[model samples]
Target: MRTHSHPPGHPHDDAHVGHGHSHGHGTDARRLGIALGITATFMVVEVIGGLVSGSLALLSDAGHMASDVAALALSLFAVRLARRPATPERTYGFHRVEILAAFVNAAALLLLTLWILWEAYTRLAEPSEVQGGVTLAVAVAGLVANLVSAAVLHGGQRDSLNVRGAFLHVLGDLLGSVGAIVASLLVLGTGWTVADAAVSALIGLLILRSAWALLLDSLNVLLEGAPRGLDVRAVRTTLGGVPGVRGVHDLHVWAITAGQPVLTAHVEVAGGADSAEVLVRARQVLRERHGLRHVTLQPGAEGQPCEQREDLHT
Candidate 1:
């Protein structure tokens, strides 16, 4: 027998319905729009500059900027999509779209990194005479644009993985811009034009480093793994420690989207105790201590023979 009640302050309570999708949707969309516009405009400038200067580093920056444009646009679309109300057919609405977008952005960064590395190797082997003056001027401009874009996105990155993915793209562009500047100075000062490829290779390495973290995070989320920094065992211990909660079994916790965690568990209550109070305490404990809001708790008598008991560790 499942016994429970959603007391005041419970996230799943009636008064708080649909709050998940509505929170921060508009702000995220606006930030993404601004970032998209900036990335798209700079990408055009970089493309033309790369063609005119014949600088591999500049061309690579343009490529990274291009991906930034796509990532920002996709993030905006996802922010909008994630606002849809949950329905019978799609209970979670479009929450997972943000995760999917993050994954795509990370994958795009990896592919771009590989391409940049290959191009850098070829340029190094051939040692093209890149126009240092044009490279320097264009790189300075690209760096300024990327810095602005990064600032525009900085606020949202810490809170949302979707925003973080776009932010990472802009950071990659920023790295490319700095690389182009260094390479241009090297080529102009000492006539070592191979610096272009060397710096481009360095940019690829930096991007690969950041991209690997994002890819792993996205893959873990898609695999339904627990959110980073959340300890499931700790949560179980805390839940079990709730007054009248004899044991916590079948506890499961995972992120439905960035910052939105969902928890479901069967809480066993000691005999002759009010399971109602136990459920309330359990929910409150999770919310107050673990920062978990969307919780579905099933209360059962202690030592009850639950047939679905095998593999309960999850």
Candidate 2:
């Protein structure tokens, strides 16, 4: 879907939401589906393997993978929901479902990381004798699966934050696999059981690092903060340069979904200029120059302030 592309003078409307783009939502869903499948399969194996091998780290990692399965499943459903037409009662067509999904995914990751850290702490306190070879074998399998998952998602990371978030999960898993491998080598060579526990701690830290970023990004989008790539001052500057536009205020920029940006503003213009023409030019500048399609431009007298500010302060 093309973005709002409406120039200055137009008010925010469903048009921006309606006309937004769907940058490869289908491919993204497919890749995530495959990744989730692999993760789920390995999660079961790792759980059983951890239990048999007596490795707390393996068990914790498996638990996190289970959550990943749920995340990917929800993301798949959200993507499909986003594509559906909005009903009479539900305009905006469930696009933000992905945003909600991102939030949940991030929160889940944090919780999972905390749990892993707890497990790591306990393991640190009492490093137990675990079958490092067995844990290593399972981890190797998980690594291959994670690599496959990452490959499937690599193509879409540039398009969707949702997709990028999923990719990060797999990437973390890959690193966890490496940590597991190292622990196994240490145990095999020197019977250092603490190495296994230490590696788990490292894995938890890595997972937590990625999770934090996702949490903030998802929250920002949900809060309707400007999209990550958006520049508020630059947007204001550009709008101010539009002919017939004297100044700008009440400017708002946000995302409806991945790669879809919307803007709304009050533009001070010549008292008698044609509102429509000024709006068209502003819309063109936003869309053609900056990739913002959803635009709302409110016209005002050259020296007047936005009616909103006046109303709010009065």
Candidate 3:
């Protein structure tokens, strides 16, 4: 029985360089800063407008924008913290900080949504006299601010879960702004004060949707679940089909962050086959087919005793 274990700094390590390292977050940080400024400025405006206009919708939007400010600020801090050098105690550096921030932002959004719904119910019971003119003007201004903030975050949103959480927050705010506008118009045309509470309820629903999605994604990563697209069964089948491979077992695939995936597996090679070639083929398949660059492959010849049996998990 021939058994081999690959070291972290093996000769083939270059094929999967930058395992846990992320680069070029400086641009993301700057973008987040700009978005943060826009959101904070509008948040103050909306708070004042909500107070003077007595519009529950406007106040709800302001509350969401306040959360957006926190989300963006946390995202920016995460990007900077992720750049710190890796340490012996924390080999993966602070990359997971961004994910943790995302989880926190999602939780905050959920809580805010619940509060908005409760407030909407109370407002519906005893409607307030909202100023249509002031509500309309303020909602329009908020809409513009939210649009700009969304544009600033859209690009980075696809690249990082942290940014995605922040983007979702801003998007929820944009929807809230739209709802506030519609409610204000309805109040102006028909004097239906109930429109304000109705809009706030709808905005809360939208926030709940986005918050649920972000929460699930962040929890999946934190729990070390397989990435969204990659199936563990398919991966094992693919590895088993590799030339000179007898079978595969103890396969694992998971994400370290939003875009980085890591894999580890034990492969059984045909007797007398070149284990080195099998190892290379496995790595290549993982990299090219699964988009997995960070991989650790252990090869064992047919009928060989599995030395890593105790450590292997399905």
User: Which candidate tops TM-score?
Assistant: 1
**RMSD for each model, in Å, please?**
3.0, 4.8, 3.4
The alpha-carbon deviation from the true structure for residue 238 of candidate 1, after best TM-score superposition, in angstroms, is 0.7
lDDT by residue (79-136, candidate 3, tens digit) is: 8898776789998778789899999999999999999999999999999899999999
Q: What is the lDDT, from 0 to 100, of the residue 228 in candidate 2?
A: 90
Query: Model 1 Cα displacement at 251 (Å)?
Result: 1.1
Clashing residue pair totals per candidate (backbone < 3 A): 0, 7, 0
lDDT accuracy of residue 187 in candidate 3:
99
Worst 10 residues of 3 by lDDT: 305-314
Ten residues in sequence with the least summed lDDT for candidate 1:
305-314
Which residue pairs come into collision in candidate 1?
none
Per-residue lDDT over 163-222 for candidate 1, one digit per residue giving the tens place of the 0 to 100 score: 999999999999999999999999999999999999999999999999999989988888
How much lDDT does each candidate structure score?
A: 0.86, 0.78, 0.85
Candidate 3 CA-lDDT value: 0.85
Candidate 1 matches the true fold with a TM-score of 0.94
Model 2, stretches more than 4 Å misplaced?
1-20, 303-314
Q: What are the TM-scores, per candidate, against the unseen true structure?
A: 0.94, 0.88, 0.92
Superposed by TM-score, candidate 2 places the C-alpha of residue 156 at a distance from the truth, in angstroms, of: 2.0
TM-score of 3: 0.92
Residue clash pairs of candidate 2 = 1-21, 3-293, 4-293, 4-294, 5-293, 7-283, 9-297
